[model samples]
Target: MTYRKKLIEVALPLDTINKESAREKSIRHGHPSTLHLWWARRPLAACRAVLFASLVDDPSNDLPEEEAKVERDRLFGILEDLVKWENSNDENVLGRAQAEIMRSTGNNPPPVLDPFCGGGSIPLEAQRLGLEAHGSDLNPVAVLITKALIEIPPKFAGKPPVNPESRGKIGNEGNWRGARGLAEDVRYYGKWMRDEAEKRIGHLYPKGPNGETVIAWLWARTVRCPNPACSAAMPLVSSFWLSKKTAKKAWVEPVVDREKKEVRFTVMTGEGAPRDGTVNRQGATCLVCDTTVPFSHVRAEGRAKHMEQKLMAVVAEDERGRKYITPTEQHVVFANKAKPSWRPEAELYGKAAVNVPLYGLTTFADLFTNRQLVALDTFSDLVSEARKEVYKDA
Candidate 1:
């Protein structure tokens, strides 16, 4: 007897598979892709079809043309049902596909292994079809994600959560299926952690001028003007436009106090267009003195830690929409209050690929402000506490 071809060797329902795969990206709840940011993640639709077809055999050539046509149509029907995103977890659909896999393999299909599984798509789909699935990767993050998607779920699949809050809420024990309890525990503990973080650092984020909650503060990096006669801190910004939407035109206007030799920025809204930004390819123009400052001077100032950040705008949200505020001394004082104790002093990656190092941002920690660093440190400590809580619940 000659070896026959597998169903995967033949054509697939590409249009149906592609359309469903595109729709899957918008599915946020309980999806493994949301576990982490893995580039070029293999879509579930493609993986499911691939696994099913690889196991089942196509019709042999020796059969009559009509017989071969019927067999091909039967296999195509299985594929059409298999690639639908909505039917991924449907027991009846999965059962039909799994039965076909068993029949083709003589009830002894080989275990699936994905040695370089970046996002656990292949192994997860294999396990979904009731097969033994194993996954590995060079990246520890990928390995952790794979374990969460395939390994850890089986151990906690049908169990009720041990956490007190979730345990109180869950009614039927039999209804607890496929990590639902685990998801509830996560939400409950996650809210608790957020509350704790707010208690610790709530004072850092003050409301905007009208008492609307201040969502974000915009700032521009500055370096002292090279001209001694007009030593103003010049802002290096590419554009002044805040919002270019139809009637909501807004931009920044730099007000130069010539006596004090300072450049203060104000938010401008409505029809009138704002002036071009200071920095360009060659150099920056001093807002106060109109003197040309070279890029070399700015680079030197950055290297010497003399570069400063000036708040340009304050973004706050109200009942209607977002409102931008002109910077005030009080708001400036709130920004100055942060003094972080920890920073990532590790060197950055290769200089050839990265451009920030040329302007003194040579470390990973340099990318964040002191306030942001403090928040990150607080969250890092809270993650450890959350893990301990998980251990207690388990």
Candidate 2:
């Protein structure tokens, strides 16, 4: 089945300050080292205003060290304010619960899904609101964290952090085990290589970038054949193709001169052409075997000129020639299989005509269910409408 086109109006939240206010705040808080702190605090309108005013109101004769200390204090105050808000009712419990509920219901609420399985903050909130919630996470730790937060037993509702020493020991043990296993694997692979064709193929064994061994012992075992006859026992040759000079003589085009105008021609020749009598108008002998070409062949017209040139240039050069001209250039062409044809109707209508129906907008209310969906839809619509109004004013 063809998928339905979905158009979504995604609205991002607005910044707390206008450009003019932001500029003023920047000037008020503009210390060389405190720019980062200034920008970070700008998201919190109250904290930003306080910090900005403090920087502007400071009456000390601006010394570099004094200014730095002031900036540091301002940043610390901002951070403290942020921490308080982050742990407050609006950001901590309520916000988390709302998010959890939305995630469980998929922004559409129940009869769509249970609102209070206590899987996340949302589920716990759902339970508090007299609904059932459900959720899942791939990470076991995340699952535990969520469960602990939502299913807090009466005695363990608030607890201190885990002991640092205990956590450190566990982490250290895991790291040690991993390192030991890696070392064992390396030792095993090294021993295996020594036992197997070490004398013959030791030089060919690969090494890591830092000149240290990298391939594990188990990996080397897989590459080795248990059946001796099927093993790669042969020595690895450097190259199989002809040397550069020989290849050039065999494949490249020869130069030709016609009516004082010289043009190079690419011509394929048989092995027999070297022994046959052929020569160009110039007295130059064949570049391959040094054989003299017959004048009749060189003077011959059309296709014969190419054959005669190939005979003289490539096939007839001397095997022991002290000086040789080799073709210095090469070019490569890449080709792939032809693409399948597009539908004629689709091609005629153009992209815009097809895209309109494909990307048509959709409402969350129509697509989802329950109070969670309702809340999310309302929030999204409010944000979108606000953005539209802002853009219209701009």
Candidate 3:
């Protein structure tokens, strides 16, 4: 009944837990982990395993050794209940776990603290194991997330949302009560916000031929040929491949109309489509006088084209999922208008802010067009209004 035996019990079920966790991924649509994209968040399984292991003690080889052995056996039964509970949300198993935790560690379990809790994974798992958990982080965002997980929920325990939506079968079956109803409110409001945003800024994001919403826009650096005779600027694009997959593979071939002194992005299909080796391999040549241009001239020296208005690809999504479309010259107009107004200060608190000035990026808002700005501003206003409304109702 040493700590080694206790460790074995904890470690034994991990393989099954890991497999179940991996399977849970496909059905984790409403999981709190998906609420926000936190960087380097620990897996729920690891946190659960470590917390359970630390909470319980093994049999002591002393006067109370026999009593300790009996408690340890009961704890082992609780461990089994925990494994079952993790796999399936059995209320009976949870009850058994709670009873065993109280039996082994008395009514008050020792509190677990994670000071630098980035995503609040450890603390959340600790709380799930029926332990009082305290978490903190230097980052305001992290702090807010931890509060949402640990502090906020318990305050509203056994209570439904202030304005609970009609849950039909989910509510009738006793599934959407307590904290679950609060989650529903969040989802409801979230959808409302998304719809509001779309109504305001839908013009900025256009639909493709299949009516798929645009998800991403790609851009490339452009440079001018230094050869004085040519004096022409061209895009420093290495590859024009939309995709490498056989089914939907496509590419853009630069049709240099020397007579017209222009280059056109012609979508190539079928046998004409370039393979990986040939794709984007060609260097930019001046449309006017056919002189080679260097990428260094474009990126470092700001040669040839206008700054920050390069549109390369328009990625769209629908029922079939995402597809990349080669953007025409017309699409570049929307992005070119998104120039920044103010530049960041060269120094902050006497230290050189080298990166900001080096890249010439002013602010996050500076990277949008006037229309986009209006749309974003309107959405922000709507969100503020909605939040205030929610708080008032609450």
Candidate 4:
């Protein structure tokens, strides 16, 4: 049987589906796509509509004009039900729609395949419409996401996902099945990982000066002064403001001590207009030797000729949204012990036709500070430990 209903005829109803899908996207409370941020994802409604239209036979086909009109109305009714099922996640309606498609296609619809499934939207929609779906992507992150969306859930459908921490205890909470136990295990392990990470390096992430919990910390790249006579290094940050709040504004100002040949960072706070001079987007001038330093001199420029300095997260924001920038003298004192030697994932290439050495960032690890690395490593190790403890036999 061939589909005889023109796609344009169903465009009106599809418009309704599109709008509802857009609304769902804005507040996706339990959507599977929210698990990971994927680039250039397609709309699920469009995927569903395309898959349904392709797989099912058009109702107006192989009928008299009078009967075709009746069939057309019935088809629209089914489309309305499909849209309703998609919005409400009603499996029964979905099953009935799938059965209708199977009947139309003589139960011989081919399994759908998406080779460049960045976020598995098409494959997921195909599966929702009761079609066997397969997806693949060059990106490992995308592959993992597609597997989680299209492979894992169905494989462990009836089975409860119980990690080691909640395996035995979940039974006491009454008939914990399917994803419920899995969610419990996730939450339990999540808290455990955080606690373990904090226990190891909590001191490094200091609270805000206002006695509020620290929300975020900002770091900057540092480089040594080119002048050999005054070999002083400083953080090459453009701006030091942690908050742009009109009344609660705060920023860091560099106090250059020409006599001592060093720069001191002071955190100034009050209700005042933003000082344009406070932000130095250009390369910083050396405080001691009165030498102009460009960004190229501080970054990884050539073979073993790059400036050496530790990365420090010197600025922080509190839970109350107050800003606090660390004093340069006090913070830089810890620099000697805070050396981070994390390597790059891959060598960065420059756009220049000439082959430049160490043109840009080389590794992912080189981007973070010592304390951040420590925290990340600790958290990673704890996750591995938790997994091993939970799934030792499996």
Candidate 5:
């Protein structure tokens, strides 16, 4: 039989049978010819097999070595290029997938949609292929990126406007100021406080050349806020404790006992006199904002025990003593006793906001659009009519 005839006969009801199950059946039946034909039709399936074999099979096997290396190289090369593009610019996988589909469909690319369009890959590719592409994504970033990639002039390629003076600038003197400003605006305030404190107390907490002082500098300089509002100010908060002897690296209040000439630290509970081990009393105030938390909030040793044990004990006792007092009277009694006499004063550090870029891609539903599918169904009819108009002899 001809290749086309054999293909039609041996296609194996792919529409009804799952590909994996069908592949397994073929292998069990020992139908090498059918397997070869199936592999030939699905290049992606072959690629996957190559990947699996490379991962599972022995490396010393000589015959598979060259093929394995080739497959690995091909996969890595594609991934590397994709990653480079993503890193340098704001492109995404959907755009790449849409481009592949467009290339497969020739110059007249089909309209595409990306339901989960992340970074707008498919729709952008469809637009480039002269097809109207629509996209949507759950992520705001994805939607924004897709719209930007699709709307921007192809010449611009979604790159930011270049600053001539800023180009090729590196190191602290060149572009460092701007980068540092961004870091400070979005990253460094907490560290700044810790550093100022350490400078004042480094002598009390002395170490080798790369000792406690250096470590403290590194630690103090790296502190950041955990709340997203403060994420823009810093990536992470610095470690305050010089050693792990302190309980679980609590936020500590640090103070210089000027009379004793010794630096001391305490767990910051945002409450009454620093816990049992608290040594520091001087508080650190924010310079950018007027907020002042005990230096403890920034310290590593300060425990975050916001509630007092006595208060909890009183609450529990009241709850257990409910039989003695009526519900209405109980509430009044609890209210009077629950009021705190002294509360710790911790100031709110200003939070920073950071902007993230997003991308757009395509969805399966786009390929099955009522208008596009209708167009495909009637395509042959339109071609036949055109042919009849042009030629009388056939």
Candidate 6:
């Protein structure tokens, strides 16, 4: 058998491919990154180009050097078109690339396999080129994201919107091609889930004092001061800086009251946020008695259930985009009242991820507040219920 090189073994127009790959991570419309967070997501554009190059020959079939150069340049032109994010769904562009693959493999192109698939980039690209795509992974989350991407879409490609509201609006406006119908249903039912959730647990998240919608709550993990004379609730905040935007600079400043033995947090804006934080790997500094608190003491407090969380600041959306404010009594009250039924309890790994277990946040659920747990459990339930609704509509 004569040895013949593929385009992957030859020129690949790499610089153009790299530019396209880098742009895929941006928050542009309809990117797969918007679908889910998978740290191992490969660049779909790079996957598309490489998969095609792997299959198609490089015109190395004993042609004259000049003729081979011409043919190679032609394939480079096709790859430039194929590797584009905009041309991903361009049928003419994809059809030409697939045709070349068929021509090379004698119309019996082998199915693509991604044995370690994370976020389904490779198989998704394989399916883009009209090839049978199979993906598998040990991580269940990866498997779920991959299955949602590769298994579901093609099954109903070119189908019309099934939901009644979408059908009512999509009346006589041509077929709902690709995943347009499905995407519309997603928008519709995603809104439904959100509305339903608000009705159930809307009060858990309250508006700020001035009636601004609360965007976030900055929390500080706390342990009692090691100094027996001071014994104040000392905060374990890594950073007090909330926002560094020149116009909206914000941070939490701790106010120590000597007479009351209390540490109250104040939300401050503009020039003077504290230069240093409360805690680092070695230890923390108690603001009250000026005692150096050791990490070992913090761990002891956590083990003894003496550690607590304090509301450092309230982030709210206002006319000015965002504003940091001191936490209101009402906001703190609502947070403690949440009674969620279920929580995931998984032990932490020391060297694998973070040393959280040392601080007695032993399980995954222990890391979140009760209100946060309620929201998580609510969203998880709604997803299941929403799936049933999609099925009924389908």
In order, candidate lDDTs are 0.83, 0.31, 0.61, 0.63, 0.33, 0.86
Best first by lDDT, ranked: 6, 1, 4, 3, 5, 2
Please name the candidate that would achieve the greatest TM-score relative to the true structure: 6
Please provide, for model 3 over 1-394, each residue's C-alpha lDDT reduced to its tens digit, 9 standing for 90 to 100.
Answer: 3332333443335565576556556675667766766788876766665667665545552328678667566665666456542443556766676665565565777789999998898998777777889998988999888888778877766555544353443553355544676675677777778888777556555566567777777665445456765545465565677776777776766666665555556556555564232113243555456565444444454422244444657788888877777775545655444433333323332223334333333445434455566665666677787787577656
Which scores better on lDDT, 4 or 5? 4
lDDT of 5 at 375: 33
Leading candidate by lDDT:
6
Across 86-147, the per-residue lDDT of candidate 5 in tens digits comes to: 22232454344334334334445445565865655455534533457688977676666655
Worst lDDT 10-window in candidate 4: 272-281
> What is candidate 6's lDDT per residue for 21-79, written digit by digit as tens?
89866734556445788886789889999899999988877578799999889889999
Error of 6 at 284 (Å): 1.9
Candidates in descending TM-score order: 6, 1, 3, 4, 5, 2
Least well predicted 10-residue stretch by lDDT in candidate 5? 352-361
What TM-score number comes out for model 4? 0.66
TM-score per candidate: 0.78, 0.17, 0.72, 0.66, 0.22, 0.86
Per-residue error at 281 for model 5, in Å?
Answer: 31
The better-scoring model by lDDT among 1 and 4 is 1
Evaluation by lDDT, superior candidate among 2 and 4: 4
Candidate 4 lDDT (Cα, 0 to 1): 0.63
RMSD of each: 4.1, 28.0, 5.9, 5.8, 26.6, 3.2
CA shift of 293, model 3, Å = 6.9
What digit string (tens of lDDT, one per residue) describes model 1 on residues 184-210? Answer: 676778887899899988778888877
Residue 94, candidate 1: C-alpha displacement in angstroms: 2.3
lDDT of 4 by residue, 251-294 (tens): 76666786676666666778653233321556566655757766
